[model samples]
Target chain A: MIPLSHFMIISAALFCIGLFAVLTKRNAIQILIGIEFMINAAILNFVAAGRFDRVAGGGQMFALFAIVLAAAGVAVALAIILNVYKHFRTINPDKIDTLKN
Target chain B: MSAEQLAFYFFASLTLISALLVVCMQNLVRSIFLFFVTIFSLAAMFVFALADFIAVTEVVVYVGGVLVLMLFAFMLSNKELLSGLQNIAGGFKFTHLAGLLICGGMLFLLVSAISAADVVNLSWIKNGQAISENDNTIHQIGIHTMTRYLLPFEVVSVFLMMALIGAAHLSRRERRS
Candidate 1:
């Protein structure tokens, strides 16, 4: 039997990778991609831990909701990112500082 | 190691490598395409974890819906996106090191916590066989959603529709002043 620790370690690794991408990447879409990775990692953790529960499957239900919410979030974020690109003609967050420091 | 162990390692490595490339590669197109592989392999990992329903949903909702949408967004706004792609090697900034440090620390902490908890022999492992045998995750999920999780299910549907409509409205052409 594959232990839960294996899955937890993998999910943690994936989350860290996503965090790295989100922190260092220059493009807005790339950051969104990192966010997707993080969400998937969290979902994997949920499903992995949920394997213990035989009756309720609460973890799977939560994963399902998380996936749906992620899709919706991506849709809205894409629309907003596209609008930002239109206004600034650039997707790099560093350059589009219209809010001013 | 057993076949299950080998397969789990295979899919896990595939997901991790592709994810690493997706983040580290300088080419935007390569990263985007690699994201497909990463997500698909992750679905396989979901299967390994016995999340059968989530495995299918991950593929359908992610690969079918989200990926295509992202691809279209990329094609629509092709310019200025790649300018940042080639500059990674020109100068390694402090942000890069900071990112690496923070992520590495987080991974270390997670590992330490996992080891401390003794998750391999949890109290529930006595029923591990029963859990594995009852692989009808879809059926379980359906019953729970219909009975216990009915409210959240309906709420999520409403949330999804609202998001789509809002995205459409937001992305529509703005009238000139």
Candidate 2:
């Protein structure tokens, strides 16, 4: 059997990549891509840990909910990003700092 | 290595590589398309982990649903604006390096913690009844969703409904009264 920690390491690396993308990517859509990575990493962790809860399948159950919530969130976020694009005529997050000035 | 180990490594590598490509590729359309690979490989990983039901859902919801939605958003956002704009995010820079450094440190911390903790020998794994590898998780998931998971199931449906309505309202072109 592959060690559970191996799974943990993979997910951690995935989360880090997502974080790196979020920090470096100027475009909001790309940032959303990063957020997807981070969310997947988290879902993977839940499934890994829930391996022990054979009786309830709580981890899998929660992971399912998490996935649904993620889909909803991405949908809403993209809609909002659409609105931002409409108003600013650009999707680069850095340049849309009306509140900063 | 055994076949299971080999399969695990294959799926895991596929997941990681596609994910990296999704973030690193300069072409937005290509990266988004690569995300299909990432999600499919992740679903494979889920199957390898004995969460077959989750695996199927991952493919259906992510590939069949979310990616298509993202692609629509990508097109609707307008090709001319995207193509005409300079892609500043594709370049390397000090800030990007700093972000990489910080995230790499986090991964390092997580790896060390997982190793030091020796998660395989945790009390729950030691004592908990392991789900037989062959037991049909789909059946159990169904029972739980209808019985124990009933409330959350209903709420998620409602949440989906809200998203449908809200997104339609939010994205529609506004008109002056």
Candidate 3:
């Protein structure tokens, strides 16, 4: 049987991948997808943690709330990105430098 | 291996692979589609992990609702975006190395902690088939969400409504009249 450690490790790897994507990708949508990946990794970790605490199920409940929140956040972020695209005619976040350092 | 372990492997593999595809694919539409696959697999894994309420919410809010909205935005935005794509040759190298180091260190810490901890008897896996029991069931989740977590739940609902109104305002086209 695959232990909880395995799940945690895989989720950690996925989280790393998502971080890498967010850092490296220039497209706003790609970054959003990466953000989704990161959140799901946390959800996976929570579920794995919740397996032992089966009575209160706090981890599972938190995970459910987190999933909803992630979706809402992504929805709003995408809308902003789309608005940025309309003004800029491109979605490359690196080049959209209206308020950059 | 038991059915539980087998199911875990199947769903976990699907989720991870699809997630990888979501990040790696070059085409935006293809990446979005892969994202749907990833979310679906994750929800399935949550269900197998005995988080039935979470699984349904994940599928409903993320895969169904949010993804559709993202797809709509993609369609509304410009289509010809080939030249704008970045060449990942140089810009991300150092950031990627840093990310690798951070993630690897965190993984090492987590594994060591799990191995060193003697706080709980992890040898006792919960009854995987006993999800129907009232303590961890959907009924308990609903009751707790309404009673104990009522304040935070309402707060989140208000936050969501605010977000919706703000998004509509932000994305609205300017009137030229």
Candidate 4:
């Protein structure tokens, strides 16, 4: 049996990568992609932890809800990004600085 | 290492490599495709962890639904934006170094925490006997969702509906001005 630490290590690495993507990416869509990675990394953690809670499967249930919410969030974010593109002609977050003082 | 360890390592590498590619790849379309690989590897990791139901849901909802929606949005956006390979003209110049430092620090901290922590054998087998057949996760999850988790389930449904409406409203083309 694979140790639980293995899963934890993988999820941690995934989370860091996602954080890097979110912090460094300038494109709105790329930021959204990073957010998805981060969410999936958390989901991985939940499912891996759920492997221990075999009785109620609360972790799995929470993971399900998280996945649903992530899909909803992505849908809304993509729409917003699309609207931003329409108004600004560019999806780069830095270039869309109309609100800057 | 056992077969399980081998599979775990394979999926873990797959997920981590694609995730790195998703962040590092400058081409937007290529990055999106790499994101797909990352999500798929994550689902496979879920399967390795024995969350079969979640794995299937990840594939259906994330790969089938969310990714298709993202692709549609990408295609619908400007043509020049799609063809350009260069990143945003002058963004991320200063932040790259800062982001690298922060993320690298976070990774080091997390790894250290995991290593220093006590390793408990949290595997599901209780006592000498395995969990009974009725302990099948899908069934248990269904029961819990209807009972203990009913509120969250209903809330998620409402949230999804609201999001659908909000996205439609937000993306609608302006007819005025």
Native contacts recovered, in order, as a fraction for each?
A: 0.79, 0.74, 0.47, 0.79
Candidate 1 regions with alpha-carbon error over 4 angstroms: B87-90, B124-130
Best by DockQ: 2
Question: With candidate 4 superimposed using the best TM-score fit, by how many Å does residue A39's alpha carbon deviate from the native?
Answer: 0.4
Model 1 chain A: weakest 10-residue lDDT segment is A92-101
List iRMS for all predictions. Answer: 1.5, 1.1, 3.4, 2.4
Model 4 clashes, total count:
0
Per-residue accuracy of model 2 over B41-127 as CA lDDT, tens digit each: 888877766788898898899888789888888887866656653445446789788998999899889899989999999999889
Winner on lDDT (2 vs 3): 2
lDDT of 3 by residue, B1-177 (tens): 889888888888888788777776767788888888888888887776667778888888886788898788777774776433433323546656776687667667766775676323445454432333345468867876887677767877887888888888888888998
Ten contiguous residues minimizing lDDT sum, candidate 3 chain B? B126-135
Runs off by more than 4 Å, candidate 4 = B82-84, B87-92, B119-135
Model-by-model DockQ, in order: 0.74, 0.77, 0.49, 0.67
What is the two-chain DockQ of model 4? 0.67
Each model's lDDT: 0.88, 0.86, 0.75, 0.83
Candidate 3 Cα lDDT to native: 0.75
Best by TM-score: 2
For this target, which candidate reaches the highest lDDT against the unseen true structure?
1
Which residue pairs come into collision in candidate 1? none
lDDT (tens digit, per residue) of candidate 2 on A1-101: 67778888989988998998899887788899899999999999888877778888898999999999999988998998899888887887888989632
In model 4, the Cα lDDT at residue A47 comes to 86
